[model samples]
Target chain A: MTADLHTLTGAYALDALSPEEAREFARHLTECDVCTHEVAELRETAARLALAVAEVPPAALRARVMAAIPEVRQLPPPGRVADVVPLRGRAWRQRLPYLALAACLVGAAVAGGVAVNAEHDVDRQRTQAEQQASDLASLMAAPDAAYHTTAVHGGGNATVVSSVSQARTAFVYRDLPKLAGSHVYELWYSRKGSMVPAGLVDSGRPSGTAVLAGAASGADGVGLTVEPHGGSKQPTTSPLMLVSIAG
Target chain B: MRAAAREEQPGAPRPGALETLLDRVSRGDRDAFESVYTAVAGSVLGLVRRVLRDPAQSEEVTQEVLIEVWRSAARFDPGQGSAMAWIMMLAHRRAVDRVRSAQASADREHKAAVRDHSPAFDEVSEQVERRLEREQVRRCLGQLTELQRESVTLAYYRGFTYRETADLLGAALGTVKTRLRDGLIRLRDCLGVSV
Candidate 1:
């Protein structure tokens, strides 16, 4: 499954995937450096194909485009204050919008056709969240916002919503099987083929939500492993949930 | 693979000119925005029109794409790709999105006859101002296997999803995906696109 996703770079760059599949591949891109590079080069190549067929528009179209420009507001660059959000705040209620988006996505796994309403739900949440938590709001509102869900080896599904433009990914664990003793679920981002510790979740919680530590852009994949309570410098056990986010 | 040092083609915007203009546009310079519009409008309209087929809708989408370039100029990251690539990606995505949405509306109306049929590929437009680019692209496309060529032209030029492309080509889904990737990789090298 993961290998198949990697080959999608060409189709993805050409906008040949269905919208849902495109979103899934885009989410994969956040962790896949190879895919990211391949997609960029492929998009450039496809754009050349666009140039090959280039035609001059009716002369009057230029006036219309220029007239419409001043009315639109330019977006602030990424990393502007408007784009930054805490990795994970203790105030979980501020994350309701993300959860709502996640819930709608959970529905998508069961019924793919229901994504249209999910999109509308996300839009509504985006508007509501904008006033409350600008960080989560901007992420949920990102034009490239995408979600990926995978089964944990032990139990339940791990759902992540990522915005490459924002360089952040938010994760939620649903019905994850609780571990025994002092063991905890530790998150690791496979950056450039090496595991970097991201965050940890308590084993007692059946469900939890948090944003991954560090920037997600260009990471190769995301992994979860059972580790000691405070977490290990590196994964001490095989990953129970290894998501090959490779492009 | 030094794309910057490639022989300058006539009628193409000079290397980095669009980037400089986009930088100024990002700073809210109206004159720079005008230059950016002039630099990109032809290709944007041409590409959108190819995907949409309706002249009026194509013009509207072209206007929307340029305005989008203005609205999102700050988001343009030159390190990832060239300014032309960035602008054309926005235009292509907008064009594809418009077609998909229109298709959805037609589907909702249960208009069976409105289903998308494969259009003829490589319909050369005589109005292309960049003959040099057209020739280069034509030459590179000519080098691909027939399957690879069909896979790419069906998806990129005709706005078909990969499954639809596979259906059109009567090939397996995996085969289409590989052909698209391999075909573009070959094209990228042939075009001297530096990653």
Candidate 2:
């Protein structure tokens, strides 16, 4: 029943078309019930993509894009030609003596194209810039982030914060010797008689464990606890340290 | 509402770069246009950053893009495209013009590195333009057939027409069209768009 719905979906997402082609399809879109319905779905996909890279272009470039928009938007509309819009049926024919009507039409067409094109151009650049910035941001947060953070822990110990989320939190901890035999180190975050088990971290010498990230903006401090091997959901022991979060 | 917003939006061309700012400057408002200039300079500067290796040259290009933007602020048309597109096109055209005018060395180098150039290192700010903001394009791009995806990317983002795309991919002309059309269709479907 669905005749290659996927391909049409892709086409609509990118707006990759000659103007004429776009117009033809636009007409079909109005008439076809399936297409109208499908458009809504595909648009969501497009929006997600558009938002993928919301990185702000450099400050200076924002002005450039804005500045260029007027002129770049000078593109002629979908199918407008160099025909003048009549000012009035009576005022039009009478004033046609100086060829002003034709001249205005030509001027308007050229001006219009330039106007539209500028707008399109700046829009394109800004979008590309933002998209690129977002890409870079994600890359920085990825496991293979180019940024290296040697988070300084208590006792002058430093551990590499390998991963960070957009919320600006990183898994942080430092060197601890491997436990011998059946013993294992557990990780827990305690706050107000309630300890949230972040995870069961290894006792691999110099291993890093995820912490309860930085601190609550106005909170007093954070505490970490250790428990028996494989760790329980609740804290069973006192914290190794009560790190103070800066206000 | 549109008129009020339009007053804040700059896009006409006048005499000097300062001339464009004159409208804002007339009411003892130099600071306002300066704010505008500073806010939207990223695309212009970024273009210079990518195209010109020499810091001085890049600065010069950036200046030119900005100055031109100021000059042409009066003619902006809000109906056709958003303000962002207008500025980017100015920057892009200036950049491309510079690339073309620089003879061949820089052009050859950039073209060589286009694919290798990762769209990274641009996270300096938080107000990105909308057109380039689509992350789904890249992610969803994975869902497409290799040929279809490449066909669209190379043609649109990479600046190739069907003919050029055909030559580069070593496919037939018709194949390129079908790839573009069908790929777009699939993308639209995935995106759920009408236009």
Which candidate achieves the best DockQ against the true structure?
Answer: 1
Q: Supply every candidate's count of residue pairs whose N, Cα or C atoms clash at under 3 angstroms.
A: 2, 102
Model 2 chain B weakest 10-residue run by lDDT: B12-21
Q: Summing lDDT over every window of 10 consecutive residues in candidate 2 chain A, give the lowest-scoring window.
A: A106-115
TM-scores, one per candidate: 0.55, 0.35
lDDT of each: 0.67, 0.42
Query: Could you give candidate 1's per-residue lDDT for residues A104-200 as a string of tens digits?
Result: 3322232111123656756764564343233443444343444445567788666555566778765656678878886678887775546777767
Instruction: After superposing candidate 1 on the true structure, give the runs of residues whose Cα lies further than 4 Å from its correct spot.
Output: A81-247, B1-16, B102-128
Candidate 2 per-residue C-alpha lDDT over A1-247 given as tens digits, one digit per residue, 9 for 90 to 100: 2354323433443444444655766777666766655444444333343234233343344344445544432223234342222122223224323332222222222211112365675686567545534443443323211111122223312221112223222233434555556444444333333334444443553433332333332322233434455445544444444332211
**Model 2 spans > 4 angstroms off:** A1-247, B1-40, B43-62, B100-102, B105-107, B110-134, B155-162, B174-195
